[model samples]
Target: MILLGYGFIQKIGSRDFFFKVIIYFALFSAVNHVYLVVNWAIDNPININRLRLYAGKGDVIELFGFIFIFCRKKLQINFRRKSYVKIAFVLLTISFLLYFSRTQAVAAIVIISSIYGYTKLNKKAIIVISSFVVLAGGFFWYLNKMEIPRSAEGLEGFLYKIKNAPKEMFSTDINVNNRAELWDKWRSYEAKLAIEQVLNDRSSTLVFGKGIGALVDLKDDFMLNGKLERKIPTIHNGYAFVFFKSGILGLSLYFFVVIILYLKAYSLKSANAISIATNNLLSGFGLYLMFTTLVVAGLYNTNSTVPLILGFILGVEHLNNLSVNEDSDNRN
Candidate 1:
């Protein structure tokens, strides 16, 4: 971690937003580590429920850091001095309310906070900040409203069989429970094995995957005594989903697309605090959702696509800002 920190610091002199993200992740991870050990010591065994809670908690922390950046930029609210910064207290209250849950509550609070920050700032800055809050709220609302796909539902049912089976299991898309229900305890480990198996055995699968209807073939009930039967090809992991449907080539394509989007977000660091915070927020939110939803929900569900869409938004913003800066330099 220290070595990673050094590498990140090395980028402090230039466009090194990627490295900065690494720093934030590392720092938060360190803090997480301390609490991890503490919680385990207190309870004798770490709580799975707490681990689940950790995802949203970590997101709240990142959001707070972004608020700090916005405060510093638009509000000029500094809290590190001798006298307490008045606006810092107000923003802190609003942030606490915003981050209490991972919902649309943040939008209203963020807008209010931005307006407070924008009071002495320019119209453009205010518009940008307000726009971000609206976009973020709209995106998350979409994710929340989206129904779990039938494929994902099938994967959930598939996972149920794996949990109950005695060395022999067959199912399809049966893993998703009613919100953290079922044998989620051992589920992720099984998904990890599935991903490993697919990665290790890519050569024999014709490098194209089991094909589009591969999962469909596995959903039959193999009953014996007029009661019930089984299924097959029920891998619940997302990358595994791509591998099963399209092979290593397909998984590679999907993986590359996500990485490229993240790289685009990182590219904006040289612009300003808003750019950096926006990029890091997207990265943090993506990774946070990736780890949480991939283990529990399927990848196709895509907990949020706001980040990729936002990355494109930032790319446009960057080009326009660059053109403006160039014209200003020419004028000077």
Candidate 2:
């Protein structure tokens, strides 16, 4: 979609003040996080999908960085004119804030990468990148620490799928890809089964679900004494979790809104302010869609991050479309 919408991203990104798009999105997405975390900490239960957006600790802080960028733009600053090294230093400081928050390694990487791009010198960029080399190694080590033997089993299951190639392509038995293929299948299946249980057991009138940490229901009992059944929760899938919480009708409404928003943002092509601003959002969404099965996204309940990021991109694209359209009208 990003490629399809390249014209749009470039158009908005082209503007002197286009960086505001990033600023607005970062702040908005962060504030959204506050909403989610509060609900989870207080409410017995909440929709995992909804929480996925802003509940993340990093989600909040990262937005602050964007706010910083926005402030700079408002002041009419230029990287080429200012102290690029100092700018990189500030961003690096912000990254530590994220590292301590829910381990947002990827977001930090992207942010630092962005900082490098905005910097003035190749030599300085190389220095920044090299300094992070240690960081890259540390992140991998962290992943190793987080990935236990059981998680390794997840990896093996993925590998088996690749080697055996499920009787059907995405059906099952996806190997080595670990969470990508199998986790996706697992989450998707789990969500469906759990929902079926809900429908059969409960009436149409939706009420609060099994309650806090109900994710670990063992054959319908919280105490593990009942039976050694699998204790899974949150459906491990974004849309599914929402449906489980809000019901099918809720999901239908959401789908309608999302589809409308996506279409409106996607229609522009290198055209104007709106399209330019929204273009990057569309690209990220496209990238996520291509490689991400339900699993990669739903993991850690990171649903909101995708949409928040996508939404920002869309907003920028929309703004760019307007810019271009006006430019054309002015010429006309």
**What TM-score fits each model?**
0.37, 0.40
Model 1 Cα shift for residue 308 (angstroms): 7.3
Instruction: Compare the candidates by TM-score and give the number of the best one.
Output: 2
Q: Taking the tens digit of each residue's C-alpha lDDT, what string does model 1 give over 1-332?
A: 32343343343422234323422443354355445545654765433334334423324334433444444434233335533334434444443332233222333243334323331235865787678779867865655465543233233433333333322222233443432332333344345445554555557674787666654222234332364534334544566567666877887887775555444444553555545444444443344334433433323534433333333334434444555588769989
Off by over 4 Å in 2: 1-57, 60-82, 85-193, 198-236, 246-249, 252-266, 270-274, 286-315
Overall lDDT per candidate, in order of appearance: 0.43, 0.44
Top candidate (lDDT) = 2
User: Which 10 successive residues of model 1 have the least lDDT summed?
Assistant: 162-171
TM-score of model 1 (CA atoms): 0.37
Q: What's the residue-level lDDT of 10 in candidate 2?
A: 54
